[model samples]
Each structure stands twice: as C-alpha cells, then as structure tokens.
Target: MIAKEFTNYIFKNNIIRFGEFRLKSGRLSPYFFNFGAFNSASKLSSLGEFYASTIIEKKIDFDVIFGPAYKGIPIALSTALSLNKKDYPDVPFSFNRKEIKQYGEGGQIIGSKIKGKRVLAVDDVLTSGKTIRNTKEIIESEGGILYAFLVALDREEKGLNTELSALEEAARECNVKIYSVANISNIIEYLNENYDKNHKFNKSVREYIEIHGSKK
Candidate 1:
C-alpha cells in the first residue's frame, strides 16, 4: 500500500517510463527510471524528502552526506536539507567536482570537510556501482569513512560477471549496506497484486524480470 503510492506517483509523474529503453549496458530494458523528469522545485524537494524518509526508516547512521560529481550533487543537497528538517539538523552535505581544483581556495571537495566523518553517499541509481566504488575511494582517501550508500532505485539486474546484482556487488566491495526507496522487485510485486491486470505493464515487467533479473 505505502509502496504502491511510490510506484503510482512515479508513473503519474512520468519519472519511470514503460516502453522500450536502451540502457548504457546496451540491453533493451522494458522500463526505465528517469530522474530527469523530476524537473520542478517542488518535485526535487519531494524527492529529497523521500530519500530522507528512506534513510530514517532504514536507521542508517552517518555524520556527513556526500554525493559524487554531476547527477549526485542535487541528491546530496536535497537529502541533507530534508534530513535537517526531519530531526537531523546540522548535517553537512558535500559533492566532489568533476576535476580537482588546483587554484586559490580550491580542492576537489566543495562542502563540509570529510576527514574523520562517517559519510553517506547519495545517488540516483545503481547501474554498475563503479561510480560508487570510486566515490568510496575518494572519501576514504581523505580519512572519511563511507558508512553507507543510498540510491533512488536498484534495477535488480545481475552484475556483469556474477549473479549478484550491482547493488550486491557494491555493498560487498564497499563493505557497507546500500539502501533504496523502491526497487524493481517492489514495482513488479505491487503491480501484480494491485492495479489493473488487464494493463500490460505488470505482464511486461514480469517477462523482463524472468529473462534478465537476478535474485536480490
């Protein structure tokens, strides 16, 4: 019920599209999660609140919020803001630059100092976990511990070389549990048990998972 609201909201807002989609892995996906559709200020704030609620619900602990360059920048800021509003006041957020700054008052990091802090890295999704692993290296290199990583979704597809999903590999490699608001499995279950059975969405998802998804 609570999770159904999330899937429905995503579909209603066009955040997740149901159709043929070509992923970077060169696989044709039945559905796609598009964070870019969350383009409005209100939507962004809501997204932040969702991520904060997931973090709180999971009871994941950390001292600082960090995001990798580019896509993760807003996620880190929004999560920090929402966490601040929801009993986590003074939680500092930071993001890395694409290129290290070598000039006056400059470095790679752009926000709260990370040394000695337990950092929670936030991002949109877990595709390969390569970016997350690199982020972990960056944080640990500076004396910060990467306590956990949170993504908006986990596709539940297997890793390139193993039956474990990308999230599983990332968790294993980073030695930290990864959390997500709603994964593809949740969507599939919600659709099958609820919503209109006549619609093709649930059936399509079932086929996709059967062909490509791995055990979560």
Candidate 2:
C-alpha cells in the first residue's frame, strides 16, 4: 500500500525516530517525525512524489498550491514539480514570506497569484493546527478560496481542548478538508508488521496513542 511504502521510506531515511521527545505542545511523544530530514535532492524529490501521489489519490482539486513560509516552501515547489511529472503539467505553486519584501517584486506572497483561485495549502504535519489556520487567513485576505489542506502525517491526537483530532478541529474551524499521506496508526502498524512484534518502542507507541489518539 502507499501508506506502508511511505512509512517505510521515512523509516529508511531516518525521518521518523522512536524515542521520548518533547513536542511543541509540551507533551512527551514516543516518536518524532522530522520532515527536515528530507534535505537532499533525492530525498526531497521522493518526498514530493509521495505528496503528489497522495494529492492525486485523494482527488484534491485546486488551481494553486500554497505553502506556508519556511519549511513549506520547498514542499510546495517539489509537489508542483512532481505533479508536473505525473501528467499535471503547468501546476502552479505559491508561498508566503515571513516578512514583506521591500525591494524587487515587493510582495508578501511569491509565485502564482492566489486571488480568486482555489488554493490548497501543503505542510509537513498537523500539530496544534495554528499554522494551518493562519495560512487560511492569509489566503482569505488575498481573495483566495482555501479548497483544502494536505499534510505528510496526521498525529491523530486530540486538539488542545476538543475531543476532535488537530486535523479534524482545523478542518472544522477553517471549513476546509485536510488529508494526510499517512497517520500514526499506519506507522505503528507498519512497524509491528515489519519489525519485531514485541518491540518495546512499538508497545510504547501503542500506549501513547491509546492515551492521546482521537476516535477514528
């Protein structure tokens, strides 16, 4: 399956590591997904292909791809390139700047103009959902309709207050659907199937999800 393959790829590349890690939300997680590990050209190209395949598999429709500042910039560009290779030639991607450029083009947004277009925001993961909401606001302010969101992984954990997962809450609050290439469950399952069935880390991950995971 694609999810299994994607999980395997991340594991092989050491993007996902099993350990006790403090998340941005201050919760101690049993594992970590470091998207930044996909730094090399080949790794980034493969990551882009995975994201593009997910977008196509989900039938996500959008006139432009929007990536948030920093980490999202390369993802947006690579996804567009991968889509182009997958028969989606002419795919346009846009990204925002942390600070308004005062020279040259002098704009907050770079690449395609999102105004009056169906925009899909792509990112690495959904944690607090704050970033995705902020992206939505930027899109709306620019006259763009946020059609949906795409992420590499869904942690499947509850929001700060709600019983809904972060992804679910973001989709509800933003009024846009969110899709992921894989979720925590897929990773755990892949590990159990491919690695030792009684691995201590796998057991810990299962317990962690039991305590914090959202209802399917």
Candidate 3:
C-alpha cells in the first residue's frame, strides 16, 4: 500500500482538504487537493518519493522527465532526485519557461534537451486535462515524444463532455498512458475503512463523488 500511505500522508499534512471549494471548471467540489501544501523540504521529498515509486512500480520508460512551467518545475526536479537516490540514476529532468529566453541559451526549455527523447511529464492532478494537453504540445513542438504522464492524484471526475473521467480522456486523447499515485476512489476507500466512518466530511465527499464521478 503505497497508495494508502500516500493517502494518509496527504491527509495528515492537510494537502488534501475536505470542504467546499470552487474548481477552475466552476464546479463546487467537496474535496480539494492542494499540491502547493508541500512547501517544506521534507514534505516535497516525500511527495517526490511517492511519484518516483509509482513510476518505478509501473515500469514506465522514458529518457527524460518534463515538468510544465511553474507548479511542475519542482515536481520534476524532486522526482528525478528521488529516483536517482532510489537507484534509478541519471534520469534527466527539464522544464519550460513561461517566457522564452531571448539571449544566450535561448529557448523555452531549461535543463536537459528533449529533442528526440521520450519524455514523462509530471504534474499534481488531472482536472480537465488541459495541462496535460498543453505539456504534450510543448514536448511535441520540441521534437520529443510524450511517453506518459504521472500525477499525485486523479480526481476521477467527469471531463468537459461529462462522459469519461479527466484522466481517462487525457490518456485517450494524448495517446499516452497516465498514472496516479492515488485517486479519489482510493481516498474514499481509505476514509471509510481507516478514518472515522461517521465523519461529516467523509459523507460529503462520498456523496459528491457519486454525483460527479466518471462512469469508467
């Protein structure tokens, strides 16, 4: 159970909160995952270990790890470091700049070159899959193939079309495998079995999922 452990870790750290929150899609959600809560060094290292473990467990093959600009930068770096320490050495990581550098090594990408490489994009969560699509475009534009995507959690909610979950849609549309360390289903199961079953937040989360969860 790495997934269970991760679920507990996120709950203990308050990285995943149960309450009313508005999403970018303008939907009211009962639960929210704040990846930015991993602010401390130890927390970030643990987060990286979770991602690295998932990548290793899944046997994902890639030449480089690419994190999208901003939030994904540290995730990519940390995962690479954790992998190296866990004996998956020399896994190069790269990230894009929000603004292209006009001088010197002038490009949007920083760190390892992605040209002709197989890239694994790392991010926090899968909501609408817009971020994943954008990252795929960036990798393709730079002559790299996006091998797969890894995220901390998969919301498992309906996509824009209200048919498939965002994760499922992203994988199908991008033609790449997408993996998560844990997902909303895992969280629900963990709460029902390990946490207080009578908790109001637990009830609320379960109800919300019943309404919003994807069909498959």
Backbone Cα, N, C clashes tallied per candidate: 0, 0, 0
User: Over the stretch 1-216, how does candidate 2's per-residue lDDT look in tens digits?
Assistant: 667789989988899988899988788998999987998999999989998999888899999999998888999999999999988858989999998899999988999999999999999988878888899999998899999999998999998787889988989889998998999989988878876867888888888888889886
lDDT for 168 (candidate 1): 87
Q: Write the per-residue lDDT of candidate 3 for residues 122-211, one digit (tens) a residue.
A: 999888899999999999999999999998998999986768998888898899989989999889987898668678888888888888
**How far out, in Å, is residue 171 in model 3?**
1.1
Model 2 misplaced stretches (Cα beyond 4 Å): none
Better of 2 and 3 by lDDT: 3
RMSD of 1: 1.8
Q: Rank the candidate models, highest lDDT first.
A: 3, 2, 1
Give the TM-score (vs. native) of candidate 3. Answer: 0.96
Instruction: Tell me the lDDT of model 1 at 58.
Output: 83
Query: What would you estimate as the lDDT of candidate 1?
Result: 0.84
My TM-score estimates for the predictions, one after another, are: 0.92, 0.96, 0.96
1 versus 2: better lDDT goes to = 2
- In angstroms, how far off is 130's CA in candidate 1? 1.9
lDDT of each: 0.84, 0.89, 0.90
